[model samples]
Target: MGEPLRGQAAVDQLLEVLDLKQIDAATFQGESPQVGAQRVFGGQVAGQALVAAGRTVDPARLVHSLHGYFVRAGDPTVPIDFHVESIRDGRSFSVRRCTAQQHGRAIFLMSASFQLTEEGLDHHGPAPEVPAPEDVPTMADWLERYPDRAAAFAASPQAVDVRYINSPGWVQPGDRDPAVHQRVWMRIDGRLPDDPLIHACALTYASDLSLLDSVLSIHGEVWGPGGVIGASLDHALWMHRPFRADEWFLYDQTSPSAGGGRGLAVGRMFTRDGRHIASAVQEGLLRRIGG
Candidate 1:
């Protein structure tokens, strides 16, 4: 693996990763963010694939839904090529399938659908009542409070800020009193372009973080030193309303079930004003290291 990017440089690298190079019609090449991880982050691959798919469609048609499967762990040192297939184009909808490959082997696959703006009746359930983002301790706060964890999360390449309302699982293993729910306030670290696709893809990348961890909150699973091993198997996202990635949003997550070496987690993204913007569902493979 290459040396890990740091601070604002890492964030710039993330934007470059998403800014794929168009190699050919319906094909693009995306570079991996050099985050010092052995394998490419699943969310990075997914977000890049979505960007590839979005490039092929008309700007008038906004992405509404995307379903992706993590086929294999990707090599972080290698650049990935994404091939998009035009599945269908309709009067009001369009669909594209994207396959991400490294060394000519498929590592991830996604199907995304875009829809033309349409007005219809709309109503959504109320956002969960939680502490305001201002009231919660920011990541910086956590880092200061628990200096040991600063090195781990501070090294993350993505330019997202995370504030946990509850104690992070890594900090409180064996304390099973925490509920199965996980809530965090997240936002892009800096100002982003006005493009809607950029915001959507940024949200997609951030969505993967702290989602599967919902399954561990109830069990108090830690990440290292005899902690559990897990990876996302599949992910699905549905955009319901427009939102900016640079603005604070609440990611409320819950695990409905966990068994058979797999756990299902679902989450909703709500703006600070309590408007539901998107929903995500993911199934992750979870296995204990030692009995």
Candidate 2:
């Protein structure tokens, strides 16, 4: 079993592993795939761009929004250059635009904003009622239950732990009664930094995981062989409040539509206490091709 580290240390280690300056604008690289169909994981690029934006901001402010597009597939072997453009700086907010490049081509572009919190009235949607993380088995446990898929699951770089609250249709693909909503509990498997932005970025990275699949859930298509090709075309996030990534956060997701080989999924991140923390929207290319 891997020993868990503190959140701060985990974030620090991640920074060390993927230092922004080390990323060459002319010749950048990415981590190799342990599993998945794409050569590079979308979450990695999203997370790295967040980190790049985070590095340029004042720590006192927190990230409240981010939008990105994956214009092209990234080569896992090449380091990615992150060019951060300062969009604006104000007393209460700061904005940045970052473009992730590989092979002298733009692979991903992102815009992120940071804001200093202030006293304000609050209102939010109620938290969805579901099984707690403890009530549900860990993803690792599920993989262990299905030994055939354990190796593939173990090799995945999504070091964060996830436990589904409303389990989607796995045994019955394209058959589960279609519902617009889903929820999951997530947190890093190890420790991470105390910095709020780091936690936000980490969440940004984890947010992409399994979100698009919610659309497929409507069709009973689980991520596996013969499941078909699915890739995020664009992603957007809006942070409403501050929260610790080290703690369990509930991600409630809903898919509004799926058509023409595309699907749109929207989600909200809430603290265990029902405090809304962030919102996300994504559209992915979902197509059933040759197995």
Candidate 3:
């Protein structure tokens, strides 16, 4: 915290960039049958709400957990008004509740907790033995190598810096053996603020990129041309430590179940140094309508 007003100014700028007002609300709105039926990007709301909640707490207290529900399809064009409610301000822990509204209706809600860290006993699951991102080609490089599916891959804004840790199935989709786990490396294209909250908001944006796709990947379903209608129903995240969003972070995802037209996926995010920074869980409607 520099000058209190200066910090506030920076937070305001971050929110403005993440603001949902300029996006098309109609196209981004609702999950009903009449809509365009494309997957409503989950990271959009998650990142926005994280920024909203982060604005409420002290900079020393970093977010450790957030739980949110997608009540309805968000109108992408209408500015989503984020109403932040201060929940608590304990000495070591603080909490915030945020509601995202469009057209006078609540489309999303979230509750997040922040904590001022202190040294404590620690243990963590072993890091996955995957190939380092440096050795692997960048996503853009890979996409250029395969000209056919480049258009589809480039459609999502997230593809800007996101890359897979494994040889992906570019095309020729069919059912294959389900691999329970998957990994990817991601980071923002430009430098971001040093404030912990900004990094966390950026993390929220990156978290949902390929999460649900992990479920489809196991079934060998390529992500285009009628593979399935996938949407995230709810998202929860726990930030275990501090990290940078401009630097590559490994997102390890797994699907424990996919049945009854629904799928559940869990994710663990770790720094290149092997420190566990965050974990996430998401459940989605993954009905296969045919390709």
Candidate 4:
């Protein structure tokens, strides 16, 4: 219904969206930013659902993983009601289920598990070599270079800075070369409150923005008219190590397969110094505009 906010304003709005209003022990209320989209952003719903679930668990227990399904398109104009269910609580782990509803219908579903911090053996693959985030083209550069996508780049919230290692799927044309992987550097542009749950929720929101890009990259397809259109069907994320979402992180993504009008993308998040932080997987319905 309105234009997107930028800079600190944007991140502030995002924070507001994530701060769900507690209606009762297991119920919370949330709303979408008036960005004029017919459907709410998938990331917003996912983040809000996580917020609701996090509120039900003990603060000492940190989220280790979450899985969510986008059951239906959420109407941004209406308020979203989230109901959290106490699924289970073991000595070291707690699980909760959350559902987002609008107009008496379910729009999203999620389950999250949290665990007490424990010392454990750990090892992960090193981060791939990539240009420093500062060296990558800024959004301003994209506006000047990719005139076709300037509108989108301009409208995007400046709260989250994104620098692509490859052309975005929206900018790719039929003649564009196919790629097996898509690498992007992104971070929340504003500082967030010192809460691990907030940071994790922020990362969960950011994760949804790009996973689908890798899916389209595999086929050299674009988005919108004359290209392929898509919607996220399900998303799952696992946090391996504690990291701040406000800092730059490398999102290395790849698509392994696509069939039956669906594509799966897997991504690994790594810190600048090569520390693997988290992993995300998503499958989306991709329909060719004109097949």
- lDDT agreement with native, every candidate: 0.87, 0.75, 0.71, 0.90
Local error of candidate 4 at residue 74 (angstroms)? 0.4
Task: Give residue 144's lDDT in candidate 3 (0 to 100).
Answer: 65
What TM-score number comes out for model 2? 0.87
| Alpha-carbon TM-score of each model against the true structure | 0.94, 0.87, 0.82, 0.96
The C-alpha stretches of model 3 lying farther than 4 A from their native spots are 1-16, 19-40, 145-148, 152-160, 167-171, 174-177
By lDDT, rank the candidates, best first: 4, 1, 2, 3
- State which candidate, 2 or 3, has the greater lDDT: 2
Clashing residue pairs, candidate 4? 1-36
- Which parts of model 2 have CA positions greater than 4 angstroms off? 1-18, 22-38, 168-178
Q: In every candidate, how many clashes are there?
A: 0, 18, 9, 1
Q: Give one digit per residue, the lDDT tens place, for model 3 in 1-291.
A: 111122234334434556433223212222211123243456767787777777667888889999999888876544567777887999999998888777788888889999998899888887787778877777667666666665554343331256677534343354244466778887765567687787888788778777887787787765545667667889999988778877878899988898888889999988888988899999988766662
Clashing residue pairs in candidate 1 (N, C-alpha, C atoms within 3 angstroms) = none
**Top model number, TM-score:** 4
Model 4 score (lDDT): 0.90
Task: Write one digit per residue (lDDT tens) for candidate 4, span 1-291.
Answer: 224466678899899989999999999999887756779989889999999999999999999999999999999898999999999999999999999999899999999999999998999998989889988877667656667666654554556888888867787565468788899998997889999999999999999988899988887888887789899999999999999999999999999999999999999999998999999999999998877
In the order shown, the candidates' Cα RMSDs to the true structure are 2.3, 3.7, 7.9, 1.7
- Model 2 C-alpha lDDT per residue in residues 1-291, reported as the tens digit of each score: 233332455445555534455444223333433344346777778888887777777888778889999999988766677888888989999998988888888999999888888888888888888777889877766655566665554444445677877563343353355556778898876777677777787788789887886887666676656676788999998888878776888998989898898899998888878888889999999877563
